[model samples]
Target: MYRFLLTRQWLITLLIALLLIPTTIKLGFWQLHRHEARVARNELIAKALTATPEPFDSLSPAPGTAVPADLTWRAVTATGQYDPAHEFVVRKRTDANGTIGYFVVTPLKLSDGKGTLLVNRGWVASGDGAADYPPVPAAPAGEVTLTGRMRADETAKGSGGFIKDRAGLPDRQFNLINTEQQTKETGAPLLGGYLELTATTPAPADQPALIPEPNHSDIGPHMAYAIQWWLFTAMIPVGVWVLVRREAKDRAKQQAEPEVTPEAVPA
Candidate 1:
């Protein structure tokens, strides 16, 4: 009975079963690894947020800075005048309640004279009936202080046309990665990266307030996914065995049945 499985058809089926088991196991392990990575990242972000704000000089933007694994989201301070004319609206930002809007970002000139830094002030809803840009209350004249997390500069997407620099403030567009194109268009010496402002006092009446909760990290699910994949891999052999047994039993039953005989007829 087992020798029949050595036939070409059974051999191919076995080969396919063998191949799928490892593939399923690999996918499960991959998910587990992702879960572990997310957990680790969550821990780093939590640590960075709780720590005291460090000077901009203390941190450096090395290559691959955007990797969430390496980014440190900490409280940092900067004194600058927000350049309202050069402001850009990051389109299609959704809030906690799923309301869609835009994030107003502008270049804030640091008082230290080091350079300008991009500030993501907050969000504004686009109401019905008209495409009106929300009034950007002037950044108070003279120097203003801002505290937020330091984010790495955005990078260009594949083929690079996804983000383009416009002559003035963009009306309707989407940018996946920050590019120097916007700065060049504005003719502003914008900083290399952007800052996500968390607390803005005397809040702007029109924009949504920033939420300060740190995102959570969980790695338990990855372990579960890995186990599931391995289980799938293990089930293949059991399934094959059951199928072979059923087929053998059916053949034996057919052989045991009595053969029908033609009835004798008068010639």
Candidate 2:
């Protein structure tokens, strides 16, 4: 009575459902890991934001060196004149309110001739997002002190390393905030980390606004999404069982009915 499940079609369907279990379980864990990573990033930002600010000379690494993990997002200051000729911008940034913009970066030539430091001046609107960028207010001439958070050289998006090219990009627009790539272009000694300018000794007006810290108030709905996916997978086998039982019941009911005899056919 239940041999139908042995048929090729039903057997194939069972196999498919069995395969979905592990697939969906893997998807659930994917979301779980995303949530965990975001939480860990928030913790790191918290610790970095609380540390005391220091001078760039103390933290700056020689050109073409990697910024250590412990120094990332560390607060530091530097005094230098802006190398406006080599200024560049990072594309696809969103402000605290989700407004789209770009972050302008200028290489600051240190006063003591030590080396240059890449400074992210701040975000400017990309309303047109065209190559014709709005004129960036010039960085103060002569020696200037800038206090900000130190960040490691950024890699190209989705890629582990930098691919230096200007194709299809606006003049001076970069896909990443890498310092080594800048060193290649300017032939200047640049620190391993770039500065996120938070303050200036004599602040210049009409410059791009400094980017605020990221929002980490919530752990987000990723955990709930993970649970939902797992629950869907768990119900697959139960649904198959219910369908098979229902078919069996219908067959039993048909057999239970007495066979109707046709009245004797009239000649």
lDDT of each: 0.66, 0.81
Compared with the true structure, what per-residue lDDT tens digits does model 1 show for residues 181-232?
5555566555555677886544445444464455655545777888888898
Model 2 residue 203 CA deviation in Å: 2.3
Give the Å error, residue 231, model 2: 1.3
**TM agreement with the true structure for every prediction:** 0.80, 0.84
Give the Å error, residue 15, model 1. 2.6
Residue 108, model 1: lDDT of 80
Model 2, poorest ten-residue lDDT window? Answer: 157-166
All candidates: CA RMSD in angstroms? 4.2, 3.2
Q: What does candidate 2's lDDT look like per residue over 109-170, in tens digits? A: 88888878899998887845467675567777777899888888876552445434355876
TM-score of 2: 0.84
Query: Candidate 1: deviation at residue 238, Å?
Result: 1.2
